[model samples]
Target: MNDLQWYRLYSDSEPIVEKELLNKLLSNGALAKFALVRHNGEYKAMLYVNGKRINGPALPEPLTTPNGEVTHWMGNKPGVGLTTSEAEMIIQAVTDRIERAR
Candidate 1:
């Protein structure tokens, strides 16, 4: 799918650039900033945007997106997106678990 919407959370940190962990945090909403990352003397495009919370804390992973694809260049790679499917899934899972418990 088109990943909910545009995206959120941008960063060039090793954790973000080294691993593509957006999907994990996408469920858990967040507020962050990102910039061009220089790793191993090489520049990768864009990595990923963390997200608002909708599930348990995301586990650590070696995540990072390669090549910062630019659809609209506003200078200095930065973007945002909103994915829906994953959010919905988290919501359902949480609700079901709660109802079953009650």
Candidate 2:
């Protein structure tokens, strides 16, 4: 994958967020080290993992019930640029979270 090419997590049906993956990510201790920022009234997260920048919209604080769903879609596109290692880490993290959630 291109280092500058943005990519979003997806399941067999829809995007990973549609499966409430954000909740799983939020609850993961490995993800807690990132910094959350509010940009233009929206929350975004920035983390340097595996020597690459991992960034994307953040789940709203004081998460809501039934999923705490918060998706960032700009013009029908939802993703962020990441390096190969960063992308692998994200995928691994999500996979681990999914397995734990099962």
List candidate 1 stretches off by more than 4 Å. Answer: 1-82
- Cα lDDT tens digits for candidate 1, 33-102: 2223233333332333443212212211111442333122111223333234433343344345445546
* lDDT tens readout by residue for model 2, 17-99: 22212212332333323333333333334343332334444422222222223322201112223333443444455445546
Query: Which residue pairs show backbone clashes in model 2?
Result: none
TM-scores of the candidates in the order shown: 0.24, 0.26
Q: Give candidate 2's error at residue 47 in angstroms.
A: 11
Model 2 alpha-carbon drift over 4 Å, by segment: 1-79
Please state every model's RMSD to the true fold in angstroms. Answer: 18.8, 16.8
lDDT against true structure, model 2? 0.33
